[model samples]
Target chain A: QQQVKQSPQSLIVQKGGISIINCAYENTAFDYFPWYQQFPGKGPALLITIRPDVSEKKEGRFTISFNKSAKQFSLHIMDSQPGDSATYFCAASMRNDYKLSFGAGTTVTVRA
Target chain B: DTAVSQTPKYLVTQMGNDKSIKCEQNLGHDTMYWYKQDSKKFLKIMFSYNNKELIINETVPNRFSPKSPDKAHLNLHINSLELGDSAVYFCASSSAGGAETQYFGPGTRLLVL
Candidate 1:
C-alpha cells in the first residue's frame, strides 16, 4: 500500500524558475510532513518540513505548502538552479511511528 | 566529521555468497535505521535499532539481520546473496523519539549476480 503519492516522476525546469512537487497521504493521523533532497551518489538531506499546524512555511528559496483538509502538501523551490537537479522525496509519519513512509520519488532537473 | 557513514560504497558478489554492510554514526544519536531503495526508487525501512536495542523490524526476510554492538554502530548482515537483493542501502540516524528528523548516509550500492 502506497501511503504517500507523489506526482510527475520526473520534472525538468529552467533556471530561475520555480520547481514544484506535490504529495498526498491517505492517513489523516499523519502530522509531520518532510521533503528531502538528494543529489547523485549521496543521501537525501532534509530540505524542509511542515508540522501541519501552519498552512505554509517558507525558508529562503524553499517552501512547503500544506493542506491538512486536502491531505496534500507541495514543495516549491523558487529560482531553481542547475545545482538543484536531483531526486526529491516526500515523507509522512504519525507522531508515534518510528519509521517514515516515503513516496516513490521525484527527479528534478534544472536546465542551465 | 561525518554524521552517518556506511562502508563499502559499492559491493558486488555472487549468488549464495554472504556479505555485510557496516554503518556508524558519530552524531551520538540513539536511534539508527536501515532503509533499502529498490529499482523503482521506493525507499523503505528494513530495521531500526536504538542504543543497541532492536526497536523496529519490518517484514524483511530472516536472511537479513542487524547487529548493534554499541550505540553508534549498527551492521547489517545478509546470509544469502540473490539478484533480487540488489539495491542501494542507506543508513540513517536521528535523535529524540519518533517522527524526529533523520540524518542519512550516502548509501551502499549492492549488486548480486
Candidate 2:
C-alpha cells in the first residue's frame, strides 16, 4: 500500500507562473517530509524538506508548506521556469527510520 | 567528485539470467539504501544498510540480495531475472541518525527480456 498520496500526475505551467504540487499521508509517526526533483535520465535530487514543527520552508524559488494536523504538505514553485521542468516526488519517513516512503511522481512542464 | 555512484548505467539481459548492480558513496555517510522505481514512476525502498549492517529490509523477493562490503559500498545481486524485474534502480546514502539528507546516484536502468 502507498503511504503517501500525490495529486496531478502531470502539470504544465507558463513561464513565470506558479506550479503547485500536493501530497498527503496517514502515518502519524511520519515526521520528516521531503520533496525531490528528477530530470530525464537522472536520479531524483533533494529539493526541499520540512518537519512537522514548521508550517513552511522556503529555499530560493521553492517552498514547502506543511500542515501537521492535516497530515498534508505541498510544494510551490514560484516563477516557474523551463529549467524547472522535471518529475517531482513527495516522500515521508520517521525521524529515526531508514526507510522512506515515496509518492507516485508528478511530471511538471514549464513552457517559455 | 560524485557523491554517490552506480556501475553499469544500463543493463539488458534475457530471462533466467543473473545480474548485479554495484553502488558506492564517497560522502562519508554511514547509511546506504537501494530503491526501485517502476515504469509507472512509483519508487519504493528495497533495502538499507547502516555501517555495513542490514538496518532495513522491505518485503522484497529472496532472489534479490544486497551486500555491503564496507560503509561506502552496497551491491545488489539478482538471480533468475524475469521480465517484471525491469526498472530503474537507485542507490542513496546518508549520515546515520535522525532525518539526515540522502544523496542518490544516477541510477541503473535494468531491462530483462
Candidate 3:
C-alpha cells in the first residue's frame, strides 16, 4: 500500500509561471515531510523539508505548504524556470524512523 | 566529494545470476539505507543499517541480502536474480539521531535479462 499519494503525475508550465504539486498521506504518525528534486540520470536531492510544527516553509522559490490536520501538503514553485523541470517527490517519515514513505512522484516540465 | 557513492552505475546480467552492489558513505553518518525505484518511479525501502547493525528489513525477497561490514559501508547481494529485479537502486545515509536529511548516491541501474 502506498503511504503517501501524490496528484498530477505530470505537469507542464511556462517559464515565470507557478507550478504546484499536491500530496496527501494517511499515516498520522508521520511528522517530517520533505520534498526531493531529481534530475535525469541523477540522484534525488533534498530540496526542502518541513516539520509538523509549522504550517508552511519556504526556501527561495520553493515553498511547502503543509496542513497537519488535513494530512496534506503541497509544493509550490514560483517563477518556474526550465532548470526547475524535473521529477518531484514528497516523502513522509515518523520521528526517529529510518524508513521514508515516498509518493509516486510528479514530473514537472517548464517550457522556456 | 560525493557524500554517498555506489559502485557499478549500471549492471546488466542474465536471469538466475548472482550480483552485488556496494555502497559507501564518507559523511561520517551512522545510518545507511537501500531503496529501489521501479520503472513507474515508485520508490520503496528495502533495508536499513545503523552502526553496522541491521535495523529495518522490509518485506523483500530472501534472495536479497544486505551486509554492513562497517559503519561506512553497506553492500547488497542478490541470488537468483529475476527480471522483476531490474530497477534503479539507491543508497542513502543520514546522521544517527534525527535520521532525516538523507544524502543519496547516483544510483545503480540493474537490468536482468
Candidate 4:
C-alpha cells in the first residue's frame, strides 16, 4: 500500500510558468514532509521540506505548502525553467521513524 | 570532495552470483541509509544504520545484508542475486539524526542477469 499518493504522474509546463504537484497522505503520525528532486541517472536531492507546524516553506523558486489537518501537501515551482525538468518525489516520515515513505513520483518537464 | 561516494558504480553479474556495493561518506555523518530505485523511479529504503548500529530494516529479503564497518562506511552484500534485483542502489548520509538533511551519492547501477 502506498502511504503517500501523488497526482499527475507527468507534468509539462512552459518556462516561467507555475508548475504544481500535489500529494496526500493517510498517516497522521507523519510530521515531516520533504520534496526530493532527481535528475536522470542521479540520486535524489532534497529540494524543500515542511513540518506540520508550518503551513508553507519556500526555498528560492521552490515552495512546499503543507496542511497537517487535511493530511495533504503540494509542491509549487515558480518560474519553471528547462533545468527544472526532472523527477520529483514527495515523502513523509515521523520524527522517530527514519525511513521515508515516498510517493510514486512525478516527472516534470519545462519547455523553454 | 564528494560527500558520499560509492565504488563500482556499475555492477553486472549473473544470477546466483554474489556481489557487494561499498559506500563511504566523508561528511562524518552518524546516520547512513541504502535505497533502491526501480525502473519506475520509485525510491525505497531497504536499510538504515546510525553510528554503525542497525536502526531500520524494511522487510527486505534475507539475501540482502548491510554492514557498517564504521560510521562513515556502509556496504551492501547480496547473495544469490536474482534478475528481479536489478535496480539502481543509492547511498545517503544525514547528520544530527534521521530527520535531518540527507546527502546522496551518484548511485550504483546493478544488473542481475
Per-residue lDDT of model 2, residues A1-112, tens digit only: 9999998899999999999999999999998898989999999998998999999999999999998889999999999999999999999989888888899999999999
Q: What residue pairs are clashing in model 1?
A: none
Name the runs in model 3 displaced over 4 angstroms: B97-99
lDDT of 3 by residue, A1-112 (tens): 9999998899999999999999999989898899999998888999999998899998999999999889999999999999999999999998878888899999999999
What docking tier does model 1 reach? medium
User: How many clashing pairs per prediction, in order?
Assistant: 0, 0, 0, 0
Output the better candidate (3/4) by DockQ. Answer: 4
Query: Model 2's lDDT to the true fold?
Result: 0.94
- Candidate 4, residues A16-98, lDDT tens digits: the string is 99999999999898888888999998889998889999988889999889888889999999999999999999999888777
Candidate 2 Cα misplacement greater than 4 A, ranges: none
Candidate achieving higher DockQ, 1 or 2: 1
Best-performing candidate as measured by DockQ = 1
Which portions of model 1 show Cα errors greater than 4 Å?
A: none
Candidate 3: TM-score? 0.97
Candidate 2 chain A least-lDDT 10 residues: A93-102
- RMSD values for the candidates in order, in angstroms, are 1.0, 1.0, 1.0, 1.1
lDDT of 3 by residue, B66-101 (tens): 999999999999999999999999999999633379
- Model 4 off-target regions past 4 Å? none
What DockQ would you assign to candidate 1?
Answer: 0.76
State what share of the real interface contacts each candidate retains: 0.75, 0.66, 0.60, 0.64
TM-score of candidate 2 relative to the true fold: 0.97
> Cα lDDT for residue A10, model 3?
94
Model 2 lDDT per residue over B1-113, tens place? 99999999999999999999999999999999999999988888999999999988999999999999999999999999999999999999999743778889999999998
